[model samples]
Target chain A: MSVKLTEDMLKALPDSRGHFGAFGGRFVSETLMDSLMTLEREYLRLKEDPEFQATFDKDLADYVGRPSPLYFAERLTREAGGAQIWLKREDLNHTGAHKVNNTIGQALLASFLGKKRVIAETGAGQHGVATATVCARLGLECHVFMGSEDVKRQSLNVYRMKLLGATVHSVESGTKTLKDAMNDAMRDWVANVDDTFYIIGTVAGPHPYPLLVRDFQSVIGRELREQSVAQAGRLPDALVACVGGGSNAIGMFYPFLGDESVQLYGVEAGGLGIDSGQHAAPLCAGRPGVLHGNRTYLMEDENGQIAGTHSVSAGLDYPGVGPEHAWLKDIGRANYVSVTDEEALDGFRKLTRIEGIMPALESAHAVAYGLKLAATMDKDQVLVINVSGRGDKDIHTIAQLDGIEI
Target chain B: MSRIEGVLKALKSQGRKALIPFVTAGDPHPDETVALMHALVAAGSDIIELGVPFSDPMADGPVIQLACERALKHGTSLRRVIAMVKEFRETDTETPVVLMGYLNPMEAMGYETFADAAADAGIDGILTVDLPPEEADEVAPLFAARNLDPIFLLAPTTTDERIRAISEHSSGYVYYVSIKGVTGSASIDVDEVARKVAHVHELTALPVGVGFGIRDAETAAAVGRVSDGVIVGSVLVDTIARHQTDPKALHQALTDLLNPMRKALDSLAQ
Candidate 1:
């Protein structure tokens, strides 16, 4: 079922209507259509202009601390005892995740559009912090919607958002998680469409959003391309990144879509286990359905009602994935796998002790999968795992597991 | 002609606007919905808009979102909603029943399966909130093949060009959202809705129904004067939320709330 991607596949996607082969389109209401069209028009024009590209590059380099390092984990590679393991150090970014790469681009777009207010939704609060950081820099009023459950789980990040001058709204709606927070953010955007720009954190949501977010976040893959050639003399044999709403993974995978020699893997949060039915691996075990403005693979019940998802890592506790990932999965362009919570926790501690680097629980999923893949490969082969965020935010979660008071 | 067209044409001939009342299929209780459909038809409604409950109603406000939750707690799947419409059909088949909600539940049932099931269940029209014309091609053909009128929404912000596009895909009528917000919002400017409805009229010959903020008899009357239909949803769901415990009170509250709006709309004919 795996069809080889043509070279033009990289530039030809989404078509004129934002569909990544029946996976995406604007499935929003009539009210949002006009604003989305205006956004699409503006984006199309700005995407072609050299000045806008220059401005984006300037912000990414100066404000976002871009060209994040690609480092070789010698100790971890020796421990794995098979393939040489490398890491993309997105954790050292300004906001501690790859989320800022997209946020800075969107905030620039918001400024160009003259939208003075911004709204965002978050689960692990990385996206919220990233959005608030950029909004504060641009002097834009920022409002963030977070599920009430997440408000308790990630309270430190919530406080950080507050300190950044963003008003955090606890969304007590369906499942009390990322999906509901997204629903509330859409509601806020619909109501205040005139002056408010919605900064969707992931490569999800409606038309221009999935396309634009991927374009902004694609800096990861573009940078990795050059950095690999410089540091390792070639692209790694395999690339791995964790998939929540799939922003980080897609960011790192977009530029390599046509690199057929390089294998791409997206790791999903497997919670207890896939067989236990307590996981958030939608691409592995979901059907096609429409939710949150895009038709993608979703964890839904037989009635088409979205199912509640469980993941130890809050970032991957989502029902649906990005549409581009869905298209890739269908076409066999990329492989998706899941690691159980126990495996992820082990991965978290292993990298910390072996490499003196603690990865966020979300990134630990990729680390867990990458280690297993590395063990099966030849020692000459290379593997790069995205250390998507720092583990400083996950200390409490890890501490509670060990029965230690923080 | 489709039942929706017959009803609207008959109303146009009589010089009366459509008083379309929207209610969730299993709100209050699953047992109460069929009878509630009867009550809405009896309360001078021209068409009945039955809401299919979804787990996440992104387009709705607090009122309808809570209503969807209440309905889902009873396990009101799309099949159950279709069965409810079938039950309503047994008593009175003249009143056109239009199922309204987001697209996921119907997509879950498969477009072909859902269209066939709905047609067999005596459904007349469908208004999937999230499925706009650009995304409606696959399902719209299936619905049309099944003789179901594929309804579409036209917002205040829709351009003239897009209005023509939506009109080409829509059959029953164009639902015009009176406000830029979700359902159950407060206060729509009557004159603004009047202007937008007029703009839609210039592009499509289909009947226009305004909804999203029509709460009281006064707003209904004011909106009825400008468009062919007035859709009231959140206020009725709000009534169900308030008096759901007492069946007798629920019936009375619905009648009391709807009768005034019905009478006011009828007065527009004069």
Candidate 2:
């Protein structure tokens, strides 16, 4: 099932009311509507302004080291014996991930809005470190809410955030993971709406956020498009990215939405497997419901309570996906798939051994699925997978899994 | 008139303020919830706000979050909560019972089905914590068609425009969250609350009930002095949590907790 990729269809999304079809409305309390409205208006005005775009571009070039190379994984393609695979190296960014691109954009927005303080929620701590990095650069107060469970697991990133002059709050709530951190952050934003700006890490949250985060992160796909044309001389046959709140995937997919020939595949965390009921593949197994200020696909029980999600990667262990992903799934524009932890571990090892690149476990989901997809296609077919982040933060988890103390 | 409106009107005619007590259904035990409601009404609760347990209550603080967790452990759900209300209405139909919860459960049950079932089970009104007026368009009409009051919340941070918009859509009464924070977070200034309640009154003719910081009788009475109703939640829910293993003790503790606030509110009117 294919829908026509029209320019108007892509541009008119999230409407004036922040809805993407029946998804992505402002489902927050009245206390939050005013701030959201203010943000939407300011973002709309500044998004078109030359000064904002120039500053953002300059930072991407000088600070974040933008135009990251789309490298051809020649050895992996030969090993797979099928399609040629290309890697969009977002892993090479300043904070070792694509998360910094978004934090930088939002921190600048926070400064423009005259907000002295910024708060964010994170699961893997990449976003937290990125937010802390940008806040330190801009001299704004930063607070990061991480689930207590993640705090214990991702201690190195926690220390890095603190060293960068940001306070790390360990939230002890329901399930004590990404979802809980988000709840705490939302509560804080509601309480401190006067001076604080909530820089949501992913393309989830309520309206304007999904749209804003997508626009800010779209630098990935925009660059990918030009590089693919210059390098491969045409768009790749397929694009693959792992989905965790879908920021990186949407960033990589948005600019190419109009390219009807470029097939999009979003891989979700399949923990054990989708049928195991422990995975975080909401679009594959869950239904639509309201959560985290947006109506989106969610892993909820029959009684409507959010179910606990499991994934080897902390970043993907959330029960809900971004609303736009839900819309994309509904419209049949993007194919949503999954990779189990075992398969992702295999992908991680294969990439490291073959390409000398240790991909983040979250990104390995895409790598894992990309390999299978490549093996089914002709050798001339090119596929680009978003290497969204590096694996330095997951070394401890990997070592522990392999029975190494460190 | 609906039960909530009738109760508010009756209290207004008597020159008295309403003291609403809140308790999560199936907290101590599911079977004991009906008795607890009876005890609250008998101890001078003009209305009962029965909390339907949800896994994630973002607007709630530690006390109520724990209450929700405890209730969820017992497998309490929206349907079970309506059943509890049905049992309570068997003997006492005079006091209004409002279902207080988050929106997901209702959305899961289907809005029309939930509204019809709620009205059938003797629910007078609903206060969905996260469903602001902007997103309440679909469910609001269903609730109204069932004669159920679709209540909304007004926070300290709510702007004048939003206040008027909420007032226009809200029925029965508007809940004035006295603090900018979540439930059971901090103390509120009585003078500031009086000023804000006055502002709310000026915008909407609906009676404003103040909540979210009234932990003791003095604070409840102070807020009740300015608002038409006083809602005491976390404190009463905390008391129930303390005596959760003993249903009789929980009932006695709830009565002891609310009786003082009831007397304080009545004394204010006097």
Residue A92 Cα positional deviation in candidate 2, in Å, after optimal superposition: 0.4
Instruction: Provide fnat values for all models in the order shown.
Output: 0.89, 0.70
- Candidate 1 per-residue lDDT, tens place, A121-238, comes to 9999999999999999999999999999899889889999999999999999999999999999999988999999999999999998999999999999999999988988888889
- The regions of model 1 sitting more than 4 angstroms off are none
Q: Which candidate has the highest DockQ of all?
A: 1
lDDT string, candidate 1, B1-270, tens digits: 999999999999999999999999899888889999998888888899999999989889999999999999999999999999999999898999999989999988998999999999999999999988888879978988988999999887888899999998999898999998989976899999998898889899999999989999999999999999999999999999999899888888889999999999999998
lDDT of model number 1: 0.93
Of the true interface contacts, the fraction found in model 1 is: 0.89
Query: Lowest-scoring 10 consecutive residues by lDDT in candidate 1 chain B?
Result: B132-141
Model 1 sits at an interface RMSD, in angstroms, of: 0.6
Give residue A43's lDDT in candidate 1 (0 to 100): 94
User: How far out, in Å, is residue A193 in model 1?
Assistant: 0.9
